[model samples]
Target: MATNAQLGADDDYIVVRNPSKLADLLTARNVDPEVVTKYLHIIRGDAKDCYTVGKTLYGINLEIADMVVSDVGGSTVVKPNRLRPTLDDPTICQDVVSNIPNSLKRIELLFKATPRTRRKPYIVVISTTGISNHGRDIAVAMDKKAMEGILLREIQTGGRGASVIRGFTAVRPSFLTDGKPVGAQKIRAAVEEEGKVAKSAIGYTISRGDVGAWIYEELVEDNAAGELKYVN
Candidate 1:
């Protein structure tokens, strides 16, 4: 239950102990000068703790020294650190249900248990088409079946789960493939409309890398807040 302020004061000495060396290492990595400066500033700030840097900051642990990255569904996901439930990071509560359980109740518990101040915006990925509407397409049908019952429901409308969080940006993309990034030119974002899939959100297959890149750009870098964006 250590506050960010307390963690910062206690950890500053580790980084401040050798700023010049750290700067040299960052410079060697060819990291942007501005990014390096910002990191240094944060390291010296009143809350000199290293909180999460990517997408959402809610489930990240600042105490870890190394940056954490994960390969999820063929996409590389980067987070400032990992969340260790009940140990260092009590803010996160995760559970995997094998058989049928009270999903709503479970989700509700996770939502209500987390402190309001600790909540952060969520970046969710979903299918552009739903099974009920696009059941003809095998991929869309499978996606809908897999996501509709749990992830989509909780994120889109589950009471405290989505409604109580700081904010959420739901990205619904078309079929995904492993290829080069499509870049911004081929990508588009629009407000979600039921039973009406736009041309940009249909008959297109985007690279997994491109999807990850878009999430990083819109959610992490641009800090794009609320709204559901359909991309392809």
Candidate 2:
């Protein structure tokens, strides 16, 4: 993430994760985590509140850059310039707090920070099928359906902030498989404003790596086919 090393660019980069685990996260992306210290700005715990935008602004004078890519597993409730928690509890208002996965709650940062951003960050969310009145239902992946429901409901809510987000694309890929990169070329993908959701042609499966690469192409490479410019 540092200065767009592999992709070739000089930009201030800030990626936060536990120091011990940071290496693995970067390594998964084919980055040499060992040398990251030379480029990345490491955030030690408690020094900065990366959650609440109000508090984080005072702490870091932050900017989420030109784009915010959210790969969160579950959907979140994005408040519309509206009320939020007093103590940063994402699981606060849900009737089924136990049902809300940690992944879903964690995305609270994505929703909260993006709206307040002066830079109109192009937001990309990896969603799943079965989000009511949308993609076909995936009976086996119960978790996916649940998250999709929550996401769609909240986004459709009257005062939700996430709806106001610009350049937002919710990629609803089918059952995600790991271990090998099948590549997006092997699968069929359809894009539409509302006519043909990607989930419609999701097929049986897609690789996580391919999804990531697709994102890299759309944002970093700036594919002429699609839009949004992040310039890695």
Q: What is the TM-score of each candidate against the true structure?
A: 0.42, 0.53
Query: What are the candidates' C-alpha RMSDs?
Result: 12.6, 10.7
lDDT of 2 by residue, 136-169 (tens): 4465332334433444455465544543223445
Tens digit of lDDT per residue, candidate 1, span 1-232? 1112222322212223256666786687587877655333322221122221221122234221111111212232335663321223211111211011232233335556544433332334344344445234224322333432443444457554444332333455667787777686567755545665444445457786687677665644343333324321
Best by TM-score: 2
Q: Please list the C-alpha lDDT of all candidates, in the order they appear.
A: 0.38, 0.44
lDDT of 1 at 159: 59
TM-score of 1: 0.42
- Candidate 1 residues lying further than 4 Å off, grouped into runs, are 1-117, 126-141, 146-148, 155-170, 222-232
